[model samples]
Target: MRKLRIGIVGTGYVTDCHYKAFKQNRNAVISGMCHTYNLSHPKYREKQESLKKKCKGFDIKAYNDFNELVSDPSIDAIIISSTNSLHFEHIVAAINNGKHVLADMPVVTDIKQLAAIEKLSEEKGISIFPAHNFVYNEAMKKVKALIEDGRIGQIIHASFLSSHSISNNHLLGWNPNSELSKGEAMFDSGHHLIYQCLYLLGKPVKISSFKSKTILKSMDCEDTMQLSMQFVNGAMAVLMQSWSKDHSKMINGIRILGTYGSIVLTDALYFNDKKIMKMNDYMESFVRLSKAFSDNILKKVPPLSDLNAVHEILEITSNLYKTAEIESLRII
Candidate 1:
């Protein structure tokens, strides 16, 4: 079988992770990469030079523009790791050019753009795989299995805690910029835990949220978000996302309570408070997610979810964000 050729857009932190993940995949090869460099900014010169070195080391082609990358017949797919705001146009370009896409999360800034993306993919017979990497974690996969096997019986409540520390680089960059990132922590990196909850428990019917900037006050956006959800099954979930804290052990951890038993996870597998299995490094989740995307493209396995599932998550996320507008946010 011919290996899938991938072109990566936006050569940055998330792109670096995707590159490393694809390198470990036997079914795919990263043929090239390109970023729509902000030529107006003198700072991007350093970024372009860095990308040149990366391309040389990997022995892959680098396009000067996204159009060229998507137009290359040698590349079978493109990874859209660009800014949150640029995802829509990038994905559309790839799909129109017959290239499959693995787009990073908060895939698009707006919920209205999702249906058009779905329509384009269907018209082109291509896949627009969302980079919802946390759900691919072995521990998360195990949790889904346990819930289905009745190990914890019927779930009553789920709590997801994301206390990640943002870097000085990202804080000074597009992440905290409202017009660029289109959101704060909850809809950004925090999207990991949000999607994982939805993945394990299914979509929620009701969502209420509060956002505040307790830390990282240099930025205009909120650094902390608290979201409460009510599922149709009558189960409840509470998510607390904080860019203010730097707790590595507590990042993306969850606790689930069911009728018969409960589970608490903080970097290790625990069932009813008994440790069952140790987990792998967090980077492993990205690799596993890449493999899933590649295998699905190869028709060797079914996708974790289809385009509709992606839309559902985006819709719920949009609704959740709308519930807490900038005016309501407390900037303490």
Candidate 2:
């Protein structure tokens, strides 16, 4: 059996997460690293220098040009940790070059890009996996299993809250004002909650959302967002995201209310007078996700992070942004 030769694209903080996961999997090898932006840009230079320092112990080639990385025959697949705006272009390049892709979430901003990628991927005969890590979480896996087992009866409503402190958005290359940014807290952080809801429940038929910049006024995008979705299964999903400095990491979990009982996932999974402690570390989710992706590639099975799944996520997110934009104007 031949090992999969994978290249790391974008070399950001999330790149380290993928690298850690790749190192643990015996079936995958980190063949090379590629920074999507040119060295002329400070961000690119910083990332390249940081990548060099990070890759000291490892033996891997560095790619200055993305086309070169995509065209390399030795590379079988590429993991794209680039900015949200660059995903479509990188994915198109990889597909055209016949390289499999595993891209970070909010894969593409527009629904048209999603349509194009799906068509291109089918024509190219390759797989494009979206890095939706929450779906692969062990604790979430237990929650999914219980839901599938009908332990909670008919799911009535679900609420997901993801809160964190604001970071240096510029260093992270996240500018909601720039075309490069996918969106503010909703597209950046809220994608996780939306996808998790879709995974546990079903596709949402309608969406209502509100967004505001309550704290981080420097950025063009909102720092907080609230989204309400109505699923086809007659269930409701409420998703909230915040990057407020005032929040000292409050309830970051999912709560599903059903006819029979309820399930809540926080640091631990609790239901029916029982508690299942989560993994010691969250990195374990990336480990399992990487293994699953590699195994699917080797076995020619479908990846859980398929482009279609990402398309649905993007569709939901797009609607949320649209609604929020309209509501923000009304508020003003």
Candidate 3:
């Protein structure tokens, strides 16, 4: 079969990551590009020029309009890597134009949007793959395999931890605004653990969560969060994320304890106190996902990350936030 002609919409950092990943895929070729960059920003012209130059160097067609990009008959799929607010609109346009979509995380803002997108996808015979890249990394794959093979036996408890800092400028978007950021943290930075828990331990039966502003007090959301879950299979998980103590010395990762052995996942995977496999770069996760997206399309198989998974994740996240509390803002 011929290569999948993937058209991309957006030129942000994630979009660049997707661009490079697709460039490495053997079964797909990036056919065109459309950007949602701010036309009023002072740097807009510079950014556009740079994006066009990059597209020209990569032999990808640059579309001035997103609609034209989606309507292009030669493009088989479109990636909705645009801003979070624009995701739904881009997704609808792509599906309407008979193009499959690979959307960034938090695929839709709410349950209603998700339902509508799902229905439209079904009606159009188009697929919308979620970009849950963290779980698609090499180490996570090994972690999943080990659990299936009983190397880790029955998981008893686990801890998933991550820490990274965000700048004030980055929060100038919707992140800091209470009206715009409600439940955003659950699927933005905290989304990985939710899906990873489901991927490893199955459905969670109970959930409790708390957050703290700490360093990001200017934002209405938390800079630190601790979420606890109890799975139907009797497994438990604690997910912790902090944006405060983001020094280079902070070693962030996942720790899983099982009946037989244990696993620790970071820049590597450790099984039974021994290092098993080194984790690939975070960007490599994007590469692996991009290749799978193309191969899945070519083979007529389901994507690694799909809307059903997103639905489950979103449901769990909703429950987590319902009872979440601000434990504290300033830590002594």
Candidate 4:
């Protein structure tokens, strides 16, 4: 009945969501948090205080120095929720520190870093679980079962659209250099679509994509991205993600198409779709993943998103970015 001590690297908005989820898990404890940036910033400090207050029984220390958090002997696992660019270094340090890691999605923007982490995790005998929370969605899980059980026989073709407004300020906050933001949409939003695609159709053999900055004049990252994947199993998937869409009336969603039936999950895929599946909101997907990781740490079960699947998703994403870049050249 020992609690799993978890250290989180990053104190951003998404990290706060993670913190809240960790607090809800009775089997997990938020041991500490690290942020290399200005933790003294009012919003950042406020979030730290809020988390501390919320996780009253947990020992949550806020550190400006990430190394200090990584070096903490009390931390049994680390969650890498840092920015896309810093994921490689942070994850490496966590792995070397001999802690199980739950890395946020788009694990690393670069293929080299992704491969290195895969190798390092194997060498260290520590597990690295990517935060592809979609796979744990009750509806998606049901859909997966339906497909597997022949309720949806032979998944023919599928499409996914994840659109949201990435305000100018938000883009600037992440990448001061406009060009860098222009390049990260695929890494940011495309990762989710690709992960879902892999979950449904297995690994893709060839991926072709078109990415461009369609709007948001000040932002350099491509606000729009369209990817077409040809899975090794002969199933094809088309994925589109955009940051320029009008979010006032719009929301994110996915559709899985099969010969017998189709499944649709919208509005972050957890809340909206859970009701459709007649499930409770208490069943958060990250909580499931956290429990799964805890079980794996206790040697009770294997990691839910195994290394091979993680590698395949990372590879597909990296390749899609490359394809997008090539397509960009052809367009020019």
Model 2 RMSD, rounded to 1 decimal: 2.5
Query: What's the lDDT for residue 308 in model 3?
Result: 75
Q: Each prediction's Cα RMSD?
A: 2.7, 2.5, 3.1, 4.5
Residues 126-154, candidate 3: write the lDDT tens digits.
88888888778878988989999998788
Clashing pairs in 3: none
lDDT of each: 0.83, 0.80, 0.80, 0.71
Those runs of model 3 whose alpha carbons end farther than 4 Å from true positions after fitting are: 37-50, 53-59, 167-169, 178-184, 248-250, 325-332
Model 1 TM-score is: 0.92
**Model 1, 63: alpha-carbon shift in Å?**
1.8
lDDT of 4: 0.71
Which ten contiguous residues of candidate 1 have the minimum total lDDT? 300-309
lDDT of 4 by residue, 124-154 (tens): 9888877877677666776677677876677
The segments of candidate 4 whose C-alpha lies over 4 angstroms from its true place after superposition are 38-59, 167-169, 175-182, 232-234, 247-251, 267-283, 327-332
Please provide TM-scores, in order, for all candidate models, with all chains considered together. 0.92, 0.92, 0.89, 0.82
Which of the two, 1 or 2, has more TM-score? 1
- Model 2: pairs clashing at backbone N, Cα or C within 3 Å: none
Name the 10 consecutive residues with the lowest summed lDDT in model 2.
Answer: 169-178
Whichever of 1 and 4 has more lDDT, that candidate is: 1
